[model samples]
Target: MKASEIRELKDEEIVHEVRRLRRELYTLRSQAVTEKLENPRQFGVIRKDIARLLTEQTARRNQAKTAGAAE
Candidate 1:
């Protein structure tokens, strides 16, 4: 998924997506070990998507913290 698409998801939805992606990544890894992976590039794509979601999650948390501190 694109960063903009990821940014549009709610925090909970983002978390869900991350979990789903992790599972997919795990499956891909297992397939790779068996040399059954059809697309080796998928690993990088999923990893990037997971990172993007986590980054967004962290940014939201930091924004919340700063906002609370400003009050």
Candidate 2:
């Protein structure tokens, strides 16, 4: 998914997506170990997606914290 598309998702949605992606990643890794993966590059793509999601999550958390502190 594109970062812009991900950014448009709500926090809860983002969390759900992250969980789903992680599970997929695990399955992909397992496949890679047991057999040759058709698309070996998927691992890197998924990893980057996870990182992007986490980065967005962290940014939102920090923004919330700062806003709360200000209030």
Per-residue lDDT tens digits for candidate 2, residues 1-71, read 88898889999999999999999999998998899999999999999999999999999999999999999
In model 1, the runs with Cα more than 4 Å from the true position are: none
Q: What Cα-based lDDT does every candidate model obtain? A: 0.94, 0.94
Stretch of 10 with least lDDT, candidate 2: 1-10
Clashing pairs in 1: none
Off by over 4 Å in 2: none
Please give the TM-score that candidate 2 achieves against the real structure.
Answer: 0.94
Clashing pairs in 2: none
Give a tens-digit lDDT track for model 1, residues 1-71.
Answer: 99899889999999999999999999998988987778889999999999999999999999999999999
Top-lDDT structure, candidate number: 2
TM-score of each candidate structure, all chains considered together: 0.94, 0.94
